[model samples]
Target: MKKIPVMAAALSAALLSVVMLTTFSGCAKKPKLYLYNWTYYTPDSVLRQFEKENNCEIIYDTFASNEELYAKLLSGGTGYDLVFPSGDYVSIMIKQNMLEKIDKSKLSNLVNIDPMVLQKATYDPKMEYSVPYYFGAAGIAVNTARVPQYEKSWSIFGRSDLQGKMTMLDDMREVLGDALVHLGYSVNTANPAEIAAARDLVNSAWKPNLIKFDAEAFGKGFADEDFWVVQGYAEVVYEEISEEQKKNTAFFIPPEGGPAYIDSMCLLKGAKNVDLAYKFIDFIHRPEIYAEFTDYFGFPATANIPARQLKKVTPYYQAEELTNVELKDDMGENLTLYDDAWLTIRVGD
Candidate 1:
């Protein structure tokens, strides 16, 4: 009486499996918090900890430069819940209404942010559209053991001796900005003539030290003594080196007032899950969490001033270098000029 037909029993099992699969699939999926950030820039442990604590999945993506991030977001329907764009792009996004205004009421951790950093976010003067995350200068990292007679200037990229043993960030603006600084022009220059001159300088002069332009090395080349000089984010090069490597490698902003950049997290205008995005940002601003990030990667955190004061998070550059750093500003309609110039630079024209 208990034995059913074999085919009938198999059919019952298949039905039950379908029901179970459908039940699990129908259950609310983890709220996805899409993050567009710098490639290899965030600590994996920190992201894992956040996911474990919040019971959410962080869908992480990366951009090599602010220009890339802006182009994607500008095309619209990016569906990113949050994005980390540098200071000038943040300003442009704010003006272009590409980001959601910060609801300060939801950000109790706002107090953790250093006023100096927040004040410098001139793109959203009231801190309405963005919150500062990493604050630092974009400059040069040198392996003194390999290139002993280094000048603390962007001019060093032009050194014939460094031929085929150097790399700069793959970003267009970063490359062009350093060339401008080397040429005694401003990083934020909107002048077409100035921008063209910077392009010419890069085309004629800065191309000597060329292994390849890279943004994802994580200072591996520098640490391994592959690149005698690397020009990119200080956070990437500064902390990735070991205690022994620190003896020879040094990070510094040029005295000519090299480009300074601030990276901030902001909600995308068409975010699918705004509340989850806010929660993630709030968690990131927590002093302990922020410390884990900076301590792990040696990045400078602006939101958690306490993190900057942590024993592991020491100062970056000398006082003179710090004083000379300059932030890039929104170029407005003139942004088109830089874009065209960047295209020319890439084409080797």
Candidate 2:
């Protein structure tokens, strides 16, 4: 009877020890990080480098548009530790208190960022809440062989002769914002009347000239020669052109002014691993890493000095042309006006 009782006690103690050990192991495991960003925005090699350096597992997710990312985050389908959103959307998120203020002490490499980028962001006045990743201009890319008079402006897309030979981005904000700017109105205008006028201009431009309104098709279409002129993001079109076709393809920043956007890294309020997130941001901001990104992706870096040095290797680089660039500012309540105008343009009202 004594032996039986002792055996039961030993078994109970062993099970308890096993449970305690398992609990401790689980607690010791590294935290997982989730990142939500644009499609093909970051190279996998960069991600692998980050993962190897940080000793953590990373889960990356991609979205096609900023609106799509907003919708997904709002819907609460998944939780993300970090996200890369455009300056306007970052401003919107900050206004909504969706982002957490970053501690500058955590990001030492932030000092390496370009002074121009730091000064120009309208969303984060001091860049307190966001770190700029890349900057790009919405411009026209023309197959010079197909369109002889392509050097003009957004008016080239309005030409009747270019009908069915032009492609525009499907993004409402970019498409409508540029149209608003081209029509001599503010891209961030809030007035209903101004928005309506811009809508009318875009609708009229679309009626005769649009081959299609697409987000991803412009680059491939330009390469295939299915479209001679495309309203394209600088990076996408630049990446899509072949070495030979690249000679024929030229990007034009509309003389009337067009929308420029900065994609930035931000932390969400409910982020679980804030320390790791900052470390990742710092890793990305390293000059060599930033240069690698710009060289491979064809997007201009906010780390302008390092990017400028890297650009010297490419014959296509033109620093003078890119110097006078601008950035998109928050529209606040005017976002509604722009959306309504976009709807009107698309629905014919």
Q: Which predicted model would earn the best lDDT?
A: 1
1-349 per-residue lDDT for model 1 (tens digits)? 7998999999999999999988787655757789999887678998998888888888899987787899888786498999999888887887778888889999888888877666666666577888887777777888888888887888888888889888888777778888887777888888778889998887777765578788789388887778889987666676578888888877877888767777889999888899988988898888888888876665555457776555365645533354556678877777788888888767666
User: Per-prediction TM-score, please?
Assistant: 0.78, 0.84
Pairs with backbone N, CA or C atoms under 3 Å apart (clashes), candidate 2? none
True-vs-predicted CA distance for residue 58, candidate 1, Å: 3.0
RMSD in order of candidates: 4.8, 5.2
**Residue 316 Cα positional deviation in candidate 1, in Å, after optimal superposition:** 6.0
Error of 2 at 215 (Å): 1.7
Q: What's the lDDT for residue 33 in model 1?
A: 80
